[model samples]
Target: MKNKKAVVYVRLKEGVLDPQGVTIQRAILNMGYDVVEGVRSGRFFELELADGNGDLSGKVEEICRKLLANPVIEDFSVEYT
Candidate 1:
Protein backbone atom coordinates (compact mmCIF):
# COMPACT_ATOMS: atom_id res chain seq x y z
CA MET A 1 0.00 0.00 0.00
CA LYS A 2 1.24 3.46 -0.87
CA ASN A 3 1.17 6.29 1.58
CA LYS A 4 -0.61 9.48 0.77
CA LYS A 5 -0.47 12.92 2.36
CA ALA A 6 -3.21 15.49 2.28
CA VAL A 7 -3.18 19.12 3.40
CA VAL A 8 -6.37 20.92 4.19
CA TYR A 9 -6.60 24.66 4.53
CA VAL A 10 -9.68 26.14 6.16
CA ARG A 11 -10.49 29.84 6.20
CA LEU A 12 -13.40 32.14 6.67
CA LYS A 13 -15.30 33.04 3.54
CA GLU A 14 -14.74 36.46 2.10
CA GLY A 15 -16.95 39.10 3.71
CA VAL A 16 -17.21 37.00 6.85
CA LEU A 17 -16.12 38.60 10.09
CA ASP A 18 -12.80 37.47 11.46
CA PRO A 19 -12.23 38.87 14.92
CA GLN A 20 -8.99 37.06 15.48
CA GLY A 21 -7.50 38.36 12.30
CA VAL A 22 -8.63 41.84 13.09
CA THR A 23 -7.09 41.74 16.50
CA ILE A 24 -3.85 40.44 15.11
CA GLN A 25 -3.75 43.20 12.57
CA ARG A 26 -4.43 45.75 15.23
CA ALA A 27 -1.58 44.40 17.29
CA ILE A 28 0.70 44.60 14.33
CA LEU A 29 -0.25 48.19 13.70
CA ASN A 30 0.23 49.06 17.34
CA MET A 31 3.66 47.52 17.18
CA GLY A 32 4.52 50.15 14.56
CA TYR A 33 4.61 47.77 11.65
CA ASP A 34 3.33 50.01 8.92
CA VAL A 35 4.03 47.61 6.13
CA VAL A 36 1.44 45.16 7.45
CA GLU A 37 -1.79 45.79 5.68
CA GLY A 38 -3.97 42.93 6.83
CA VAL A 39 -4.08 39.64 8.64
CA ARG A 40 -6.28 36.59 8.12
CA SER A 41 -6.45 33.62 10.40
CA GLY A 42 -7.01 30.13 9.09
CA ARG A 43 -6.59 26.48 9.94
CA PHE A 44 -4.18 23.98 8.47
CA PHE A 45 -4.53 20.23 8.77
CA GLU A 46 -2.18 17.53 7.58
CA LEU A 47 -3.62 14.08 7.10
CA GLU A 48 -1.82 10.87 6.21
CA LEU A 49 -3.80 8.30 4.27
CA ALA A 50 -3.25 4.66 3.64
CA ASP A 51 -3.41 3.22 0.17
CA GLY A 52 -6.38 1.40 -1.44
CA ASN A 53 -8.88 4.04 -0.53
CA GLY A 54 -11.13 4.56 -3.49
CA ASP A 55 -12.11 8.04 -4.63
CA LEU A 56 -9.41 9.79 -2.65
CA SER A 57 -10.39 13.26 -3.82
CA GLY A 58 -14.01 12.69 -2.97
CA LYS A 59 -13.09 11.39 0.44
CA VAL A 60 -10.89 14.38 1.12
CA GLU A 61 -13.57 16.82 0.05
CA GLU A 62 -16.10 15.04 2.19
CA ILE A 63 -13.82 15.21 5.16
CA CYS A 64 -13.26 18.91 4.60
CA ARG A 65 -16.94 19.68 4.24
CA LYS A 66 -18.13 17.44 7.04
CA LEU A 67 -15.49 17.77 9.75
CA LEU A 68 -12.72 20.12 8.83
CA ALA A 69 -14.70 23.21 7.87
CA ASN A 70 -18.10 24.81 7.99
CA PRO A 71 -19.61 25.13 4.54
CA VAL A 72 -21.82 28.06 5.52
CA ILE A 73 -19.20 30.44 6.88
CA GLU A 74 -15.90 28.96 5.82
CA ASP A 75 -14.12 27.79 2.68
CA PHE A 76 -11.58 25.03 2.35
CA SER A 77 -9.14 23.62 -0.17
CA VAL A 78 -7.54 20.19 -0.23
CA GLU A 79 -4.15 19.26 -1.61
CA TYR A 80 -2.85 15.70 -1.92
CA THR A 81 0.72 14.58 -2.44
Candidate 2:
Protein backbone atom coordinates (compact mmCIF):
# COMPACT_ATOMS: atom_id res chain seq x y z
CA MET A 1 0.00 0.00 0.00
CA LYS A 2 1.17 3.55 -0.67
CA ASN A 3 1.98 5.85 2.24
CA LYS A 4 -0.47 8.60 3.10
CA LYS A 5 0.01 11.76 5.16
CA ALA A 6 -2.47 14.30 6.39
CA VAL A 7 -2.03 17.77 7.78
CA VAL A 8 -4.77 19.28 9.89
CA TYR A 9 -4.80 23.03 10.22
CA VAL A 10 -6.60 24.68 13.12
CA ARG A 11 -7.25 28.37 13.44
CA LEU A 12 -9.56 30.80 15.13
CA LYS A 13 -12.54 31.81 13.07
CA GLU A 14 -12.99 35.39 11.96
CA GLY A 15 -14.29 37.82 14.63
CA VAL A 16 -12.71 35.69 17.30
CA LEU A 17 -10.19 37.20 19.67
CA ASP A 18 -6.62 35.96 19.30
CA PRO A 19 -4.50 37.20 22.18
CA GLN A 20 -1.43 35.22 21.19
CA GLY A 21 -1.47 36.57 17.68
CA VAL A 22 -1.89 40.10 18.97
CA THR A 23 1.06 39.68 21.30
CA ILE A 24 3.25 38.36 18.51
CA GLN A 25 2.30 41.28 16.32
CA ARG A 26 3.24 43.68 19.08
CA ALA A 27 6.61 41.98 19.54
CA ILE A 28 7.31 42.24 15.85
CA LEU A 29 6.54 45.91 15.91
CA ASN A 30 8.83 46.34 18.88
CA MET A 31 11.61 44.66 16.89
CA GLY A 32 11.33 47.40 14.25
CA TYR A 33 9.59 45.34 11.56
CA ASP A 34 6.95 47.94 11.00
CA VAL A 35 5.68 46.46 7.78
CA VAL A 36 3.62 43.87 9.60
CA GLU A 37 0.21 45.27 10.30
CA GLY A 38 -1.26 42.23 11.95
CA VAL A 39 -0.71 38.61 12.74
CA ARG A 40 -2.82 35.51 13.17
CA SER A 41 -1.67 32.48 15.09
CA GLY A 42 -2.65 28.91 14.27
CA ARG A 43 -1.55 25.33 14.77
CA PHE A 44 -1.28 22.18 12.66
CA PHE A 45 -1.10 18.49 13.26
CA GLU A 46 0.67 16.02 10.97
CA LEU A 47 -0.91 12.61 10.89
CA GLU A 48 0.62 9.57 9.27
CA LEU A 49 -2.32 7.51 8.11
CA ALA A 50 -2.60 4.09 6.53
CA ASP A 51 -4.60 3.97 3.35
CA GLY A 52 -7.70 1.96 3.95
CA ASN A 53 -11.22 2.26 2.67
CA GLY A 54 -11.06 5.20 0.18
CA ASP A 55 -12.64 7.55 2.70
CA LEU A 56 -9.63 8.75 4.65
CA SER A 57 -10.43 12.39 4.04
CA GLY A 58 -13.89 12.05 5.48
CA LYS A 59 -12.57 10.33 8.54
CA VAL A 60 -9.85 12.91 8.99
CA GLU A 61 -12.32 15.75 8.75
CA GLU A 62 -14.54 14.09 11.29
CA ILE A 63 -11.57 13.69 13.58
CA CYS A 64 -10.73 17.34 13.20
CA ARG A 65 -14.22 18.51 13.97
CA LYS A 66 -14.78 16.15 16.86
CA LEU A 67 -11.37 16.27 18.54
CA LEU A 68 -8.76 18.61 17.07
CA ALA A 69 -10.87 21.73 16.77
CA ASN A 70 -13.66 23.49 18.60
CA PRO A 71 -16.45 23.84 16.09
CA VAL A 72 -17.88 26.87 17.86
CA ILE A 73 -14.77 29.07 18.01
CA GLU A 74 -12.29 27.52 15.59
CA ASP A 75 -12.32 26.38 12.00
CA PHE A 76 -10.28 23.52 10.60
CA SER A 77 -9.07 22.45 7.20
CA VAL A 78 -7.44 19.21 6.10
CA GLU A 79 -4.77 18.57 3.51
CA TYR A 80 -3.54 15.25 2.19
CA THR A 81 -0.03 14.80 0.99
Candidate 3:
Protein backbone atom coordinates (compact mmCIF):
# COMPACT_ATOMS: atom_id res chain seq x y z
CA MET A 1 0.00 0.00 0.00
CA LYS A 2 1.14 3.51 -0.72
CA ASN A 3 1.41 6.10 2.00
CA LYS A 4 -0.61 9.26 1.60
CA LYS A 5 -0.10 12.73 3.00
CA ALA A 6 -2.25 15.83 2.90
CA VAL A 7 -1.07 19.40 3.22
CA VAL A 8 -3.54 22.19 3.79
CA TYR A 9 -2.98 25.94 3.75
CA VAL A 10 -5.52 28.47 4.96
CA ARG A 11 -5.40 32.23 4.44
CA LEU A 12 -7.70 35.14 4.98
CA LYS A 13 -9.38 36.65 1.97
CA GLU A 14 -8.02 39.80 0.44
CA GLY A 15 -9.11 43.19 1.87
CA VAL A 16 -9.60 41.71 5.32
CA LEU A 17 -8.11 43.60 8.22
CA ASP A 18 -5.16 41.59 9.51
CA PRO A 19 -4.42 43.17 12.85
CA GLN A 20 -1.75 40.63 13.71
CA GLY A 21 0.10 41.25 10.50
CA VAL A 22 -0.12 44.97 10.93
CA THR A 23 1.19 44.81 14.46
CA ILE A 24 4.12 42.65 13.42
CA GLN A 25 4.96 45.01 10.62
CA ARG A 26 4.97 47.97 12.98
CA ALA A 27 7.27 46.12 15.38
CA ILE A 28 9.65 45.32 12.60
CA LEU A 29 9.82 48.96 11.59
CA ASN A 30 10.47 50.01 15.18
CA MET A 31 13.29 47.48 15.37
CA GLY A 32 15.05 49.21 12.43
CA TYR A 33 14.00 46.70 9.82
CA ASP A 34 13.24 49.56 7.46
CA VAL A 35 12.78 47.32 4.47
CA VAL A 36 10.02 45.35 6.15
CA GLU A 37 6.71 46.30 4.60
CA GLY A 38 3.93 44.00 5.77
CA VAL A 39 3.04 40.63 7.17
CA ARG A 40 0.22 38.12 6.75
CA SER A 41 -0.64 35.15 8.91
CA GLY A 42 -2.07 31.85 7.83
CA ARG A 43 -2.54 28.28 8.97
CA PHE A 44 -0.98 25.03 7.85
CA PHE A 45 -2.33 21.57 8.42
CA GLU A 46 -0.71 18.25 7.66
CA LEU A 47 -2.71 15.04 7.65
CA GLU A 48 -1.77 11.44 7.06
CA LEU A 49 -4.18 8.90 5.67
CA ALA A 50 -4.06 5.28 4.74
CA ASP A 51 -3.76 4.55 1.07
CA GLY A 52 -7.22 4.36 -0.40
CA ASN A 53 -6.72 4.78 -4.12
CA GLY A 54 -7.60 8.50 -4.17
CA ASP A 55 -10.93 7.98 -2.56
CA LEU A 56 -10.19 10.32 0.33
CA SER A 57 -9.23 13.47 -1.54
CA GLY A 58 -12.79 14.55 -2.15
CA LYS A 59 -13.77 13.96 1.45
CA VAL A 60 -10.80 15.94 2.66
CA GLU A 61 -11.60 18.85 0.37
CA GLU A 62 -15.14 18.80 1.60
CA ILE A 63 -13.97 18.95 5.18
CA CYS A 64 -11.79 21.92 4.44
CA ARG A 65 -14.48 23.80 2.57
CA LYS A 66 -17.22 23.14 5.07
CA LEU A 67 -15.51 23.26 8.43
CA LEU A 68 -11.86 24.22 8.30
CA ALA A 69 -12.36 27.45 6.39
CA ASN A 70 -14.96 30.20 6.40
CA PRO A 71 -16.15 30.28 2.82
CA VAL A 72 -16.99 33.97 3.01
CA ILE A 73 -13.73 35.14 4.52
CA GLU A 74 -11.07 32.53 3.88
CA ASP A 75 -9.59 30.36 1.20
CA PHE A 76 -7.86 26.98 1.47
CA SER A 77 -6.15 24.44 -0.68
CA VAL A 78 -5.25 20.80 -0.15
CA GLU A 79 -2.35 18.93 -1.64
CA TYR A 80 -1.86 15.18 -1.54
CA THR A 81 1.31 13.23 -1.84
Local distance difference test scores for all models: 0.89, 0.89, 0.84
Question: What overall lDDT, based on C-alpha atoms, would model 3 receive against the true structure?
Answer: 0.84
- Candidate 2 residues 4-78, lDDT tens each? 888999999999999999999999999999999989999999999976656578778889999999999999988
The TM-score obtained by model 3 is 0.85
Clashing pairs in 2: none
Kindly list the per-residue Cα lDDT of model 1 for residues 7-39, writing each as its tens digit: 999999999999999999999999989998889
Q: Which stretches of candidate 1 lie over 4 Å from their true place?
A: 1-3
Error of 3 at 67 (Å): 2.0
Which is superior by TM-score, 1 or 3?
Answer: 1
TM-score result, candidate 2: 0.90
lDDT of 3 by residue, 1-81 (tens): 343888889999999888889999999999989997779988889988876565687878898998888889888988877
TM-scores, each model vs. reference:
0.90, 0.90, 0.85
Model 3 regions more than 4 Å off: 1-3
